[model samples]
Target: MPRTTLAPTLALMLALASPAAATQEYILPTLFDVAGVAADDVLNIRADPNPTAPVIGTLAPDATRIEVVEERRGWVRVNTGEGSGWVNSRFLTYRTDVWNEGALPQGWQCFGTEPFWAFIPQGDSVVLGGPDTPNDMRKVQSVLSTGVFRDPTRAVVAEGMTLVSTPQLCSDGMSDRLFGLRAELVIQGNQPRMLSGCCSIQP
Candidate 1:
């Protein structure tokens, strides 16, 4: 067979073997926030095409300002100011809408394990609670599930007096598991509340 024909034949074979062959590639926007660590330590970003491989230094975190990079196999390759490195994709947040300056929604809070949450009025509120530990400054660390919201008609918000947005570091944090969530509740309201967190809800 001609060399050119051979290439096409091989391509077809590979496609047939791949389960995602029929799926269209959709590039989604992502957001990367500084996870509790000082911006200086967040430096030394590296890449990990292979999760099992040691992280390879890509750049200094301070030098790079671009948010959201392409991800592969549950990992995201971030470009530090100096180079590129791979971080677990679960640590980053992906959003379809980018927040515009001075255009944020009212009463909505952006909450996450990455030390940031924005509050917008009339927006979905997320409440995340997990195991309480004495050493944890935030006193809570966990994610929310998509099914958490029960009633769309009622405004969702976070409740409890101690619910302030702060960074909490955990070695086992993963984004896909609802590392952070938004809920609707009154900050000053007095009511018993059960919030979802890192672990599954018991029946």
Candidate 2:
């Protein structure tokens, strides 16, 4: 017939160690979906965070997997072609089901201009293509990361190439779409070549 109580310090430690306390912070360069907007309307991407800021672009009501690279006040920043724009965070919803461990997020793709090329991960292999080069399939050697889920940097090693991406603002140089990751790719051969570009998790 005895009751026990945890000491205040121990209780605090326990609380901090709980699953709730260990929840992931919404880091930048993360994905979001358009929400709370009328299906007939579009979510405006403003040149600034203010509501009256110039409307530079818009996202469809059903838009999903949008890469938000920065956040301030009640607004989020996203790439809009050659530049970036701000959108009201109230109209956006953070995506919960995305990139985990060291695996590439579904729909992950990277591309760059000048020497336009594309890198796509498909299950256990990767598809590398470009305007000047034919599409080639390469086996994935490994996927490496910092091991922290909220950390948004990762590397994918394939048969003849390695791609490393970091959570940063990246522009495709010819699109109105912004990207969340800056990618550097290296292809091995008699003459090794390196390329740089932007990456997006959106399909």
Candidate 3:
């Protein structure tokens, strides 16, 4: 028998032409990012849980409420309001709803380099206060999803705004190795803002 080989591109095409290739064969991730959403680029929803699947729709760069109903490999099924379809799971970020209410600090005095920040929570609302604060302070409400790029933890959102807070801390007490919470603010039609500080849960 003579040895022979085909180009990678042609090989892929032939594989797709095969009936088996059409079958769903990809693995799925255990967790789904239903609440998470795309931050910048549009998120493509496909007919199948695979990138090669036909693109049925696209989500806005700051789109939200995206739900993942299925998963295959790293791809997730999503409902784009238009219809239900699949999209790459990595495209979605942690939904703001992931924030654990119990984990939130009733109030926090965060220590940063120079100007400090304080977080005071009242009812469903929160206040960000600081000497350098542009205004007396900024008031925000806790909403379901935040547009954070990769934060899969707690988040707060308003009409055109979203706020994110880092978890309590990985280390106990103050240590150079222990990095504390740094609140992030995301608002539509504006640049992302950060309130970098290490905080202790209000006592």
Candidate 4:
């Protein structure tokens, strides 16, 4: 992490003025894993993106080499060997860590400074609002899926997205509750933005 506060010195001023003073987060894409579910909790490869879509097949156990077909309305169309169907894109990540628990943390309720943006992770989707957003509809969370989060310090690529804090502490105006956060976010393929303020994750 870059120094949060710079020292008061002539050399420090020059150092702060340089472009290196601001760092862009890097995306380290990896094979995303979708496991750690009970038999009944297996991901349902649906015919479409909506929950009402018919279930074509469940995700095959130990399935690898999966291909991303497309993404729409926060759902990703994948060609899993068992079948081709739409799954909640947010549920799918790009990391290979195994978490055989029920449901994992949703994503984040993160904010930035200059062009302030807020990401609220609600279950399988996110609610995004920021300076560039023009209206409520535009605030919909549909960030491209780059991969899941891994690595100890969260230095991994979320060129997709990630879970940062305990879900319980992730509501708005609760920066006081956020804990153990490494200030970084891979918002998209190329837009690796820095976390400017408080951030949290939801389960």
Candidate 3, residue 34: the lDDT equals 31
Provide the RMSD of all predictions against the true structure, rounded to 1 decimal.
16.2, 3.4, 18.0, 19.0
User: What is the per-residue lDDT of model 4 for residues 1-203, given as tens digits with 9 covering 90 to 100?
Assistant: 24444445657889878776753222221233465545456777788789998987776545543334345788766544434577675556654332212332234345655566665545445555677885222223333322333321222222255434221212124222222233444454366555544443322
Backbone clashes counted, model 4 = 7
Off by over 4 Å in 1: 1-27, 34-44, 51-66, 95-203
lDDT of 1 by residue, 1-203 (tens): 59999999999999888867643232322244434345556433444566566655533343322344346687665544344456665444443333222222222233323323223223223343323422111222222323211211122323432332212211113332221123322233456532222111100
TM-score of each: 0.26, 0.84, 0.32, 0.30
Q: Candidate 2 lDDT, tens digit per residue, 117-181?
A: 99988779999998898999999989998877577788999988999999887778886666778
Computed on alpha carbons, the lDDT of every model, listed in order, comes to: 0.36, 0.86, 0.49, 0.45
For model 4, what is the error of residue 18's alpha carbon versus the real structure, in angstroms, after optimal superposition?
11
Deviation in Å, model 2, residue 93 alpha carbon: 1.4
Off by over 4 Å in 3: 1-105, 108-111, 134-139, 143-152, 158-161, 168-182, 187-192
Candidate 3 local Cα displacement, residue 175, angstroms = 8.6
Model 3 lDDT tens row, 58-159: 867666444333456877654444345767777666443322333342333334544455555555555555677742234454444333322324555544
Candidate 4 residue-wise lDDT at 79: 46
Give candidate 1's root-mean-square deviation (CA, Å).
Answer: 16.2
